[model samples]
Target chain A: MASQAAIGFTRGAPSLDIIDTEGLVEATRLAFAEDPAGTTAYGTAVGYAPLRKWIAEQHGVPVEQVLVTNGSMQADAFLFEQLVSPGDAVIVEAPTYDRTLLNLRQRGAEVHPIALHEDGIDVDAVQALLESGVRPKLAHIIPNFQNPAGYTLSAPKRARLLALASQYGFTLFEDDPYFSIRFEGEQLPTMLSQDTSGSVVYASSFSKTVCPGIRVGYLVGPAEVIAGIAKIATTTYISPNMVSQSIVNQFCRSGRLDKSIDTVRAALRQRKDALVAALERELPKAEYTAPQGGYFMWVRLPGVSIDALADAAAEHGVAFVKGADFLLEGGDDSVRLAYSGLSAEEIDEGVTRLAAAVRSLDA
Target chain B: MASQAAIGFTRGAPSLDIIDTEGLVEATRLAFAEDPAGTTAYGTAVGYAPLRKWIAEQHGVPVEQVLVTNGSMQADAFLFEQLVSPGDAVIVEAPTYDRTLLNLRQRGAEVHPIALHEDGIDVDAVQALLESGVRPKLAHIIPNFQNPAGYTLSAPKRARLLALASQYGFTLFEDDPYFSIRFEGEQLPTMLSQDTSGSVVYASSFSKTVCPGIRVGYLVGPAEVIAGIAKIATTTYISPNMVSQSIVNQFCRSGRLDKSIDTVRAALRQRKDALVAALERELPKAEYTAPQGGYFMWVRLPGVSIDALADAAAEHGVAFVKGADFLLEGGDDSVRLAYSGLSAEEIDEGVTRLAAAVRSLDA
Candidate 1:
C-alpha cells in the first residue's frame, strides 16, 4: 500500500514545519490545568466563554455578539442556514472558495456569481444587480487575501459594498479567515467595524495561524443574530468541540498566538517568494496576481486552453485545484496553487512540475 | 449579571467528576508525542486514520464504511440531509430527543411519531403505518439506553425493526450513542451488526464515555453511502477536528478508554440508584420504568397536570426538561430527569425540590 508521492498545493493548509506543535501541546496542558471543567463538559452554544470574549474584544464587539464555532466554514454554514431559504438570491465572487459555493448551492440558493477584479469584486456590478431587482438576502465576501484569487478587497470597494448592502437592505457576510496572514499591505478595518446599519456578519479562523487541527473559528454580528445562530448551533452539534477551543483560548491568552502568527507570516512569505520566482522563471507567459500574503496564488497561462492541466500536473507528481472548481462557470485556463502547505523547495519543485505539464498540454 | 444557580438535570452530559481528565491529558501528551503530524494537519473526512480503523475493527466493518464527525448529532444531521427531503415521511419515537424533532421539522419532513413501549418502539404500529402506504424514507431508533426515555430496545424488537426496514425499503438509522454506558442487562447486538440487507446506517459518540467536550462521533454504513456523507462533510467543515479525536485515539490505543468507561459506568450507576430512591421516597404516585442503565428516567405522575413543572422546579433551583418538549403531542404528565450530570447528593436534593414544586402545583 504505497501511496503516490506528490507535491500537494491543492489544499490551503499550513506546512507542518511552521506549526508550533510545542506551543499547542503546552496550551492543551494549560487548558486542562486552568479550565478543566469548561473543557471537559458541554459548556454552552456560545462556545468557550473566554475564547468568545477574546474574539469579541479583538473585533470590538460585545460578548453577546460573538459565537465561536468548529471552524470558519461551519460559521459560514450556520450564517447561511440562518439567513438563506431555498430560492433566496445570494451573491458570491465568481471565483470564490469552492466549498463556500458548494454549501450555498447545496442549500438551493439562487447563487449569482459576480466578477472579482484585482481590487476585489466589481462593486458597481453589485450595485447594478441590486438596482435591477436581484434582491439578494446576503452578499458573501472574503475581504483580505481572498481564496482562489489571492487578491485583497480594496478599502474603497469594501466601503462601496457596505454602502450598497445598507442601501439595498441586504446583509454582508464577510468571510475573512485569511485576514491576518498578510505579508504585505497594512491591515484594513473590517466591514463589521464600519457598519452602522448592522449589515455585516464577520467570520475568521485560527486554522491558518494556529493550525488546521484545532479547527476553532468564530463569528461577530448583531446580538440578536448571534443568539439566533446559537440556537441553531445548539440543535446542530450541541455546542462545538470545546476541548480544542479551550486550548485555543489558553493559546490566545498566553501571547503565543501572536508569536505563532508572526512565525506563519514569515515562513509563508518565504514560500510565496519562492513560488512567484519559480512561476516567472518557468512560465514567463503565465498570468497571475502578485499575492502579498496568505496561502494561495492564482495562475493562468495566456493563449493556453489547457483544460487537462490538473490531471497532467497530477501525473507529474504535482497536485493543484483547477480554477473551474471555484466558479459557477469559466476558469478552465486557470488554477489556484496554495503555497502555505509546502516548503520553499517544494513550491519550486511543484511549480516546475506544473510548468512541465503546461508544456505537455501545449505539445 | 447574577446568574441563578440550579442543579441541572436538563443536559445529558457526563458530570465532570466521572471524566478521566488525567487520562485524557496523558492521551493528549501521547498524541503530540507519537503522531504530531496526524493531529496538527487537515486530516481526511474519514477522520484520524488509526481511530477510524479502530472503529471499523470494533464494528467488524471495513474502514471504508465509517465516517467520524464532530458529534453524533452532526452524524444524524448529515444522514437526515442525505436521505430525507421536504414532505418525505420519517418515523421517530413519540418521545424522542427534542433536537432530533427540531432538526426534522426544520427540514420540513412529515414526521410520524411512533409509540415507544418499555421494550422499544411498537413495530406492529409501524407495520400498520406501512400497510396504510406511509412510505417512510427512514426510521430513527436509539436501540440501547435512549435519551430522555433511557429504555433499551429488546432483542426481538430490534430484529423485527430490521426485518421491517428490509421489507419496506427504508433505512434503519441505529443511533446508539449510549450503547457502552450500560451498567445492567446483557449487551445486545446493534441493528447494524444484525442487518444482512443494506438497510442500516449506525451512529455512536465518544461524548458519553470520554467527555462531551471531545465531541467525536461516527457513522457506519455501506461504502457508497459513507462516501456520500464524507463528501457532504468535506463541504461542511473541511474535516472533523483531529486534535481531540487524535487524543481519543491515543486513549483507546493505550487501553485507558476501557478503564475510563468502567469508571463512568460505576459512578453513573450510583447516581441512577440515588435518583430512583429519591423519586420513590418523594413522589409515591409517580409512574416510571426502572431504568437499567444510562442517564435519564422518564417520570409520569398519574392524574397530575403539572404543565408548569419545569418552571416550578427551576424556581426551586432544580432543572429538568419538560416531557412535552420531546413529543409532537401529549406529554403534559411527564418529564425526563437526567442523572448523569449530577452527584448522588445533588440528585437527592434536586428530587426533593422537584417534589416540593409538585406539591405546590397540587395545592
Candidate 2:
C-alpha cells in the first residue's frame, strides 16, 4: 500500500494553473512602492482601511459593518469567543466543516446538529428545535456550495433562516466562502444582504478566489459586533498581515480579482464536470450531490462501508475523505471528493481508481 | 481640548526610513517566482516549514520546539488559551504591555503584578509572591527592552527566573520582540536556552526586524507545549499568512534580514540619543533611565500629575503615553516617550515641547 502512493482527491484547494502569479507580484510591488511604511507598520485591528473600504463598497455596506481578518476562520474564532458561553446551545450542520465543529466544541458550546438536504440545511428541523425550547446562541451555516456536503442553501431556506434568527434572537453566522464560484446557477442573495434586523454575521474568504496563502477574509455584521470582534482581534493578534492585505487591496482595486475569479471558475467547472462524468460512468450506484460552484462533491456509496472503501481506495492509489470525518453522527456510507486541485484528466483517472476500490470493498 | 492638536510620541513603531522597501519587494517577487503554488496554497497550522526551520536554526533549537504564529500576540493568545484556566493565578510585570495584561484579564486570570526595575523585573517580589503560597500557572516576562519601560532583564535574573519557573512548576513566557534591536548591550541568552525542565516558552517577533506587515512570529518551548499551541492555532486560524511567511523566508535566506536589523539599530540609536539629550537640556527635573536600546524611555515627573501633563502636552503639540495606561496600579506621575518612529530632530523638538507642557502644568 505504501509503495503504490495515493493520488489525493481530498485537498480543497484552487487549481494552480488559474493562479495569477504575475498579477500578484505586480500588486505586491505596487503596494511596497506606494506605501512601504504603512504597509510594514502596525495596522488597525479591524484591517487595512483601503481594503476594508473596498470590501464595503463591493458589498454595498458601510465600512464599519465589515472587519477584515486573517481569514474567515479567524472571524469564526473571534465570533465564537465573543458569543459562546459554556453549555450554550449552538446549531451546526450535520455534515459540517469539521474544523468549525471542533472550534465550537472547544469553546464548550453545546452543539446541536441539523440535517442538511439537497437544497440546503433542513430549516424545518431548525425551526422544530427552536420551538422545542432550545435557545441557541448562534446558528452557523455554510450557505453556498457548503463544504463536504456541497449543497447551497435554497433562497426560501435562507429567508426562513434569517426570519428565525430575528424572531428567536440567535445570531446567524453565514459562512459563504464559495458563493462567487457559481458555474451554472443564478446567484442567490446573501443572507446578510437580506438581513435587516442585525442578526446575520456574514463571513467570506478570498482563499477560494484570490489565494489562500495571502490569508485574507472579511466579516460583515452589526457595527457593535464588529467592534467587539475587533477588540478580541487586538488581543488575539495585533492585526492581520498588512503586506498581504495591501497587495490584495491593489489587486482588487486594479480589477484583476474578477478576472482571476473567472479563470478559477472556468478551470474548476471543467474539473468538476470531468469528476462528475467519471463517477457516473465508473460507480453507477454511487449517490452524490452535483455542486454548482464549490470544490467538493459529496458521494454516498450505499451498502458499502466508507472505512473499507477509503482503505481500498488508498491501496488503489486514489484517496478521498471519509464522510465520517465531517459528521458528528452517522456517515459510514459516504465520502467527499475534492476536485479543485486536480486537473480534469486527474479527476477522471482518480474516479476510475476509486471505482476499482469500491469493487474491492464489495469483494 | 479638541482644538489643541497633538504630536504623537506614543507610537511604539520603527522609523519609516529604516524599513527596507526595495529588499522586501524583491523578496516578495522572488517568492512568487519561485513557489507560486506552495505560496498560495493551504499551509500547515504551525507555519511554513522553511520559515519555521530557519527560525529554529537561528535560535539553536529543534524545529519541533517552534510554533510559528500570525504574530507574537497570537502566540500570547494561544498560550493563554492553553494554560490559563479561569481564575488561575498568573504573574505579570507591574507596567507590562497593556494588551497582554488586558488579554490575561479577559481570560479571567487572577493577575499578580511584579514590580519592574531598571535592570529587569523585580525577581525578589516574584519570589516573595510564590513563597506566600500563590501558585501562578505562568509568569509572563519581557526579557529585552520591556515595552513602555525599555528595560532588559539581567542575565543573572534571567537564570533566576527560569529556576523559579522550574522550582514552582510554572511556565515562564519570555516575550522578547526587541532583543535583536539592542544597540549597546552585552546580549543575554534567552530563558528558553537556559531551561532544562521544559518550563520556558520564549516568543519573539520578526515585526521589529523584518516588517510587521508580514505578521510573522514564533514560539520556542517544550515540544509538547508547542504542539498544543499549534492545535489551538489550527482552530483559531488554519495557518499564518503563507505569502508573507514565504517572502520573509526569502528575505532571511538571502541574508538581507541582518542588514535590515543593522539599519533599524542605527536609526533608533540616533533617535534615542537625541531624545535623551533633549530631555537633559529642556527638562532638568525629569528623571529617566537612558536605555541602551529599544523604542521607549520611561520618565517620572515629580509633583506633576500625568493626566494634567498629558493635557498640557497636547496643548503644546507634544503627546506621549500616560504611564497609567501601562500599569495595573499607580503611574500617575509617569509617562512613556517612544522615540523609534521620529527622526532625531523630531525627537529633540518633541521633547522640548513636552518640557513646555510640564512647565504649563506647574504654572
- Per-residue alpha-carbon lDDT of candidate 2 for residues A167-253, written as tens digits (9 for 90 to 100): 999999999999888887889999999998999999998898898888999899999999999988887788888999999999998
What is the Cα-based lDDT of residue A51 in candidate 2? 93
What digit string (tens of lDDT, one per residue) describes model 2 on residues B1-363? 446556678988886788898999999888988888778888988898989999999888899999888889888889999999999999999798989999999889999998999989999999999999999999999988889899889988988888889999999999989999999878888887788999999999888998887889889998999998888888778888999999999999998999999999999889889988998899889898888888998899899898888777878898889899888889989999998889998888788888888888767
Candidate 2 chain A has its poorest 10 consecutive residues by lDDT at A1-10
Q: Which is the leading candidate under TM-score?
A: 2
- Give Cα distance to truth, residue A44, candidate 1, Å: 2.3
What TM-score results for chain B in every one of the models? 0.97, 0.98
Q: Write the per-residue lDDT of candidate 1 for residues B153-220, one digit (tens) a residue.
A: 99999999999999999999999989888998799999999999999999998998899999899999
Q: What TM-score does prediction 2 earn? A: 0.98
Q: Evaluated with DockQ, which candidate comes out highest? A: 2
* Window of ten residues with lowest summed lDDT in model 1 chain A: A1-10
- What's the distance in Å from true for residue B4, model 1? 9.7
